[model samples]
Target: MLIGVPAETMAGETRVAVTPETTKKLMAQGHSVRVQSGAGVAASVTDAAYQAAGADMTDAAGALGCDLVLKVRSPSALELTQMKPGAALVGMLNPFDAEGLQRLASARLTAFALEAAPRTTRAQSMDVLSSQANIAGYKAVIMAADRYQKFFPMLMTAAGTVKAARVVILGVGVAGLQAIATAKRLGAVIEASDVRPSVKEQVESLGAKFIDVPYETAEEKEAAEGVGGYARPMPQSWLDRQKLEVAKRVAQADVVISTALIPGRAAPVLITEEMVASMKPGSVIIDMAAGKGAVNADGSVGGNCPLTEADKTVVKHGVTLVGETNLAALVAADASALYARNVLDFLKLVLPKDAAGIEVPLDDDIVAACLMTQGGEIKKT
Candidate 1:
């Protein structure tokens, strides 16, 4: 099989879907690898490095016209024109984008949106969300620390004492948990909240306080549990109670990192204007859910905070809001490396080790969930 790795064309996107290490493995497995010249340059992977690892450096059109194409973002209209029909494509294709899926289906491409994969034991290695979210969580805290005027740790000087920063994390998923752990390492007092009750132990294990908004009704309890390890939208009654609890913590917080999101849904408003107004003047907010989430009525990026402008940093209510959507892309090297490995793991399911053909197993849950488009139809699950 011929495999292509193309340069990402999304604004501010620096991640590549394939790296030299993974390229080498595929080349050794009787696969012909084609990479766009300088595809991995932003990630510090030189063209010569890819060549050394047995990849044929080619133009974007050349690479796109292959048996299989791997990318970080979905192809643009021009790119779609260059691809061969029936060719396979794998990437974090933003499955929520109905129009994008439709375009891909119209092109008759067999597409796999990796973000849609199940979070099961067998699919762990191929979990792109967890791998990338881990990086975003760590980077969010770093962004907060940079914007904050004071130190995270308390200091006792001969002149005076500097108090430790109070950090709050919303949506204690993989990213939220990492935010707590990262803030704790910086000597800040951390508090985290999530709809799911199971993560309380995970939060406590990391030495952070878990903000509990107990479910008042059975419906709230069921919704709070979430589905397939991803969060579900909560009832308004529960959300109102949560807001009350979080508002109290936000008032005194030095840093707030919001990671709350429901898959294929607009990001919930976790940090409201009122909450932002009450925070300290020098406090920082790193909204990791900025541009990647918030599917509006017209399908624009909405954020955890309604005031958050995607990919832009805003100073509101005398507080700093770091609404950077590409925190993982900021650390492009490792993020692409981990994502490339995840893609490689998923390939084992469809691409044969010894043969030259791609096989899509409909019986496999991972494959079925990821197969958004096949045979010119939107086969969304």
Candidate 2:
């Protein structure tokens, strides 16, 4: 099979879909791997390195025209024209975008969006969300600490004693848990909140206090249970109670990291403008779910915090909001390396081990869930 790795064209996106380590693995599996010239440049991988791994270096058109096209972001319209009919594409293509799916269908391309894979033990090895979210979570704390005026760890000086920074993490997903772990290592006092009551143990296990919002009604309890290990949208009553509980923490918090997100939905407004107003001056917030590709009336994508303006760092109510969306892109090398492994794992379902061809197993659950468009039809799993 001919596998192509194209350079990401999205502005400010530095990560590539494939890395040198995975390139050699694919070559050993009897596949011809071709990468666009300078595709891995941003990830600090050079053309020579890919060549050393036995990959042919080519141009954008040449790379996109392969039997299998790999990418970090979804292909743009111009890029679609470069691909051949009936070619297969695999990457983190945004499955939520109806228009993009239509384009892919029109092109008669068999497209796989890895983000749509189910969250099961069997699918864990190929879980792109967890791998990238882990990076986002770790980077969130680092970026928050860098932006804050005070140190994360408490200090004792001859002149005086410096108190440890208080941090509040919202949404206890893979990213939020990692954020807590990262902050704890930095010696910060941590408190976290999540709709699911089950995660309280996870928070306490990490030595952080869990801010619990009790379910007053059966509806709230049922909603909190969520699906596939993801939190469902809570009832307004619970949300109100949560806001009141979170407001108190926000006012006293020196740093805030919001990682809340529901798949296929706009990120819930966890941190409101009022919460930002009450936070301490010089505090920093890293919204990993910022600018989640939602265009606002003002023509800008909003972040988890109401005050956040996407992709920009601004001080609102004396609190700094870091609204960069591509947190995984910041750690490009590891992100690509991990993502490449996931792609390779997923390819095994379609490509046989012995030969240079693909036989996509459409009946497989993981493959079915990820098949956004096949044979010019948007399949519903």
Candidate 3:
């Protein structure tokens, strides 16, 4: 089978879908690969490296016109429209995007959403969320560090003793945990919180204090574990209590990182205007869910946007708010490697017995599970 890896067309996107390392693995499995010229350059993976790994470099048309297509995000309409009927596409497809969904249906392609991968033990290694979030979490801290005026670690100098920066992390998932660990490593006095009780130990293990506030038992536990063990929406009451409790801490912290998200749903607005205003000037807030409208303050809302820097954007609450667009792209090589692994694992399950051919197995659980649309129909829960 020929696997196509095209350059990511999304603005601010620098990560490639496939890397030389993964291309080598694919070739070892008897799969031929075609990467769009310069696809891996931004991620620092050279075309020469891909050639050495047994991948053929070509133009977008040649690459996209393959047996299977792998992408970082859904392709542009022009790209999707060019797909041959029955060609397979797998990636982090935003199933809820109405226009994109419609274009996908019109293509009559076998499409899989990596975000829809089942959360099971067998699927752990193939989990793009975990792999990508790991990098995102690490990058969030770096972004916070850059925005913050004060140093993270405590310092002793001839001038005087400088105290460590106080860092707070909200949401203790893979990204949250990574943020906690990264902040701690930088010598920050970190405090972490999550609605789920299961992560208290995980937070404390990283030498960060855990914040526990009062809330209704049902809402508390449910919000912590999130929906389907994925992040979920929080009730107004719990959110109200959280705003109050977290405001005081935010006011004092040097940096705050918000890593809350719900799969295929909008990100919850964990911080309000009061929360941002309460914080001292020069404090930083990295809203990981900003792309999903998850960041909101009294006057401003943060979520994913088509906004570019020239838009004269302002984080007005005296808080520097960064809505990370493609944090994983900051570390392209690893991101591509992990993304390819997920694509490869998924192919192994969906591919036909004959290496050269594969039928869209609509009846298969993994197929039905990840396939968002087929035959002009949307298969969604």
Report the lDDT of model 3 for residue 79. 90
TM agreement with the true structure for every prediction: 0.96, 0.97, 0.91
> On residues 210-315, what C-alpha lDDT tens digit does candidate 3 reach at each position?
8886667775666756554576666778777777777778788888888777665666666766677778888888877765663334434455321211213246
lDDT of each: 0.92, 0.90, 0.79
RMSD (Å) per prediction: 1.7, 1.4, 3.0
lDDT tens string, model 1, 97-166? 9999999999999999999999899999999999999999999999899999999999999999999999
For candidate 1, the TM-score is 0.96
lDDT of 2 at 138: 94
Q: Score candidate 3 by lDDT.
A: 0.79
Ranking by lDDT: 1, 2, 3
Clashing pairs in 2: 1-356
